[model samples]
Target: MTELLSDQRIDEALQGLPEWRRVGDAIERSAELASFPQAIEVVNRVAERAEAANHHPDIDIRWRTVTFRLSTHSHGGITEKDIALAGEIDDVITDV
Candidate 1:
């Protein structure tokens, strides 16, 4: 299993991911997509990645926006997995 990241490590990772923010013990970002279908597609991509990593984010999808909040529930805090997943999501949506 992937190990949870330390607080310091989480801080360092968030530096390059400006859209993501620390909220309580999780990292969060809200994405405004072009349409609801596009948002669902984004969610699908994220789901594939999460399944592969065995880590998942709490996702909320609206009409044209998707919000992702990630945390290591087992560890009761943010972790490297959350950062990695967030980065992956950001990359996937960069050209969308």
Candidate 2:
């Protein structure tokens, strides 16, 4: 089982993830893609990465925008898994 991250640790991790911010006990980021298709494309890519990491995020899609929220449900808060997945999501977004 993963341990929850301390607030200070989360803060330090957030520095490297400029697009992501702390929301409650989760870390989230929203991306605006070129179109609905592009948004779905990004979501698909994120899904692949999430599967690879064995960690999934809550995804919300509206038009050309997609928001990803990462948290460890078992741990009931943020963890290193969330931070790492957020970075992978950022990389996936950059690739698309």
Identify the leading candidate in terms of lDDT: 2
**Model 1: worst 10 consecutive residues (lDDT sum):** 1-10
Top of the candidates by TM-score: 2
lDDT of 1 by residue, 10-75 (tens): 788999899999999999999999899999999999899899999999999889899999999998
All models: lDDT? Answer: 0.90, 0.96
Q: Write down the RMSD of candidate 2 (Cα, Å).
A: 0.7
Off by over 4 Å in 1: 1-4
TM per prediction: 0.91, 0.97
Minimum summed lDDT over a 10-residue window in model 2 is located at 45-54
TM-score of 1: 0.91
CA error at residue 49 for candidate 2, angstroms: 0.9
